[model samples]
Target: MRAVVFDQFGAPDVLHVATIDRPEPAADEVLVKVKAVAVNHVDTFIRSGGFRTNLATPHVAGRDLVGTVVAVGEHVQSWQVGDAVWANSLGYDGRMGATAEYVVVPAERAYPLPAGIDPIQLVASVHSAATATIVLQSVMQAQAGQRLLIEGAAGNVGRKLIQLGHQRGLTVVTTSAPRDFERCQALGSTQTVNYAAGFESHFQLADQRFDHIIDTSGKVALATNLGLLKQGGQVTLITAPKTNQFTFPVRQFYTRQQRISGFVISHATQDQLATAAQWLNHAFAAGLLLDDQVSVQPFEAAAACHAQLEQGQDHGQRLVLVPSK
Candidate 1:
């Protein structure tokens, strides 16, 4: 098996493909012959040691994969030897990843892939779309006919939120660069605002308040944006400030009955992954999700992909890797 491994992570150059022994499935796990894997910002964070989690060195970098099951554990009764599956690899929890020819995933974490879906598109959706699902379906409990404002709408999770928001029948407004407005609109945003022009000057064209706001920008303050929400509206943060603590305005929060929460997909459980996988499978099968815009690269280009991601050059396209033959 050839895996992308980083012995001491500092830069993208530290990541390299190495031939290693293939891993076998445990009693509760399954071995997948890797087909495609998506590269995420979290992969960079973990590799560079910027994330808060403690990881073993020489880490195999990646989290989400689309693959075919080659072997299942003796106790695994639900899946078979030839099932096409997609999974969140749980890489942050010291689990092996899919940036290789093979990977071992906990049986509960892997889900059968929907037919007629592209492997690249399915892999792209797993990590980011799952987080959006958690925020909308679980945290916000968003309802149809509601309104949502998605901050940083052009990024990976932000793009998924727009599509997911539409699926839930929400009127979606998004923030992004002026150049990305059309792209956001094509993804189903009813309104798009360029935050670079000025956050306050451009965010809202109407006097309407949003029912829910999800901030993926990581730079916005909850205190500053609270007024944009309607009374009893919810705000969810996928990204936070450097300090991790935000200044909560008690008076405003109490007066408007606004609610706020933060979510990190790294902390997601096996059950959550299963739920997300099921939902995504249906979404892809229904023609709600497509692979036309996803970026494909050879698996060996992982390091170069990481560099482009770090410099903020790669946006608007979900990058997935196909294993090199």
Candidate 2:
């Protein structure tokens, strides 16, 4: 199998397409024939040695993929050969990944792909949609009719959050660059705050305090935003800060019962992934999730794609890699 492999972490130049042994399924896993996979920020982060987990040499570079099942392990009774499926890459913490002709995924992490759904669009939506769904459904416990604010809402996850908020009848407000204000509105954001000016700009236009706030941007101003949250409100941080520290209004936080939470999708349990997958499958079948903005490239162009992403050249579209023409 030819795969995008990296022996060391540094720049996109470290990645290359090379022949590697195809992976076999374990007792609880299934072997998938690769079709299309997505290149994500975490893939770049891990490739550049930014994550804390110890990396194994010759690591594969991809996170989410859609493909057909070629084989199943003895214990994998729920799936069989020829079932179309999609899954998050099991590539972190010394596990093998999906950027190859074949990859193995634990059965629980793989979800059935609905008929008539385009694999390219499905791959683009998997990671970001799942992350936003888990955060809104599980972490933030967002409710309909509540006011929710999303910071840095121009990215993939932020767009999904806006759509999900609208589907649930929540009033969704977001902070984004002026360039992305109209795009965010098209994705269902009720209000757009020009964060390029300042966070105060968001506060200025808000008519009411938010019940929940989700910060997709790593830069957080918890101290200044505490006043923007209503009593018993919550804030969810999707990314870590550079300084690895955060300061907030401790007195107000305690007095108003406000809460802060952070999580990485890499740590999601099987149930969480399943819940997200099921929702996405239904959404796709219902023609609800549209990812026409994604960019598709050849699998062998992994290195160039990573470079483009690092240079901010994607123009806010998810980049996907198809294994072949």
Candidate 3:
């Protein structure tokens, strides 16, 4: 099997396609023949030695995959050799990655792919949708009829957040560029504000206060979002600038009984991943979460895809890599 492997972490150029031995499933695992995998920003971070260290030699760096089950371990009864499955928990925490012709998945982490969905679209959505699920369902514990404000609502996770939040009966408001207003509205945002056009003033003028606020842009100031929250409301921060530091009105935050939480998909447990997978499968089947802008590339182009993401050139498009024959 051929895998995109990086012997050392540095630039995207460090990644190269190499012939590697195929891995077999352990008693609790299953082997999948990779059909398509999505390239993520975190993959670039790991590849550049920024997010994690002490990786395996010749490490593979993909985190989500759509594939077919080719072999199942003795203990795996839920999946057969021909089942179509998808998983998003690989390529981190010392687990083998999905950017190969064949990868091993722990049986509990793989979920059946929704019937009649494009594999590229499904694979493109898994990583972002899982993150959105963890943020909304697990971290914030968002409820219906509450007003939810989403910062940077045009990006992948932001788009998913809008759809999922709306489906959950929340009144979804969004902040993005003017160009994305209609796009965000179609995704389920009831109200859209141009972030560049005096964002705080727009909300303040409307006297809008949200039960929950989530910042996916990583560019919004913490203090700015805190003012938009209602008493006892929660603010979830999933992305941050490189500085990773913020100054906010701590006294006011505590006095109002407001809560702020940070989440990363990598920290999600197997149970949380399973729950997210279930939601994603249902959402995809229902045609609620789909990536219309997807660029398919051969496996060998992994480095170029990583470079594109790091350079901020993806332009809200999902870049997918398929195995090279």
Query: Which residue runs does candidate 1 get wrong by more than 4 Å?
Result: 52-58, 196-205, 241-248
State every prediction's TM-score relative to the real structure: 0.90, 0.91, 0.97
Please provide, for model 3 over 1-325, each residue's C-alpha lDDT reduced to its tens digit, 9 standing for 90 to 100.
7999998879999999999888989999999999999999889888888887445445987989999999999999999999999989888887888899999998998999888999889998888888998888999898999999999899889999999999989999999998999999999999889888468888888898999999887888889889989999998988887788999999999999999899988888999999888888889989988955899999988999998998999887899999963
Report backbone clashes per prediction.
0, 0, 0
* Model 3 weakest 10-residue run by lDDT: 52-61
Q: Candidate 3: lDDT of 242?
A: 76
The best-first sequence of candidates by TM-score reads 3, 2, 1
Cα lDDT tens digits for candidate 1, 175-250: 8888989989998999888776347555445576889998887777787678789899988888878788778689
CA lDDT scores, all candidates in order: 0.82, 0.83, 0.89
Candidate 3: list runs displaced more than 4 Å: 53-58
Model 1 residue 190 CA deviation (Å) reads 3.0
Q: Which candidate is the best by lDDT?
A: 3
Error of 2 at 316 (Å): 1.3
lDDT of 3 at 185: 96
Q: For candidate 2, lDDT tens digit of each residue in 251-310?
A: 889999999888789888778888878887887787756654888888778999899888
Any idea what lDDT model 1 has? 0.82
Worst 10 residues of 2 by lDDT: 197-206
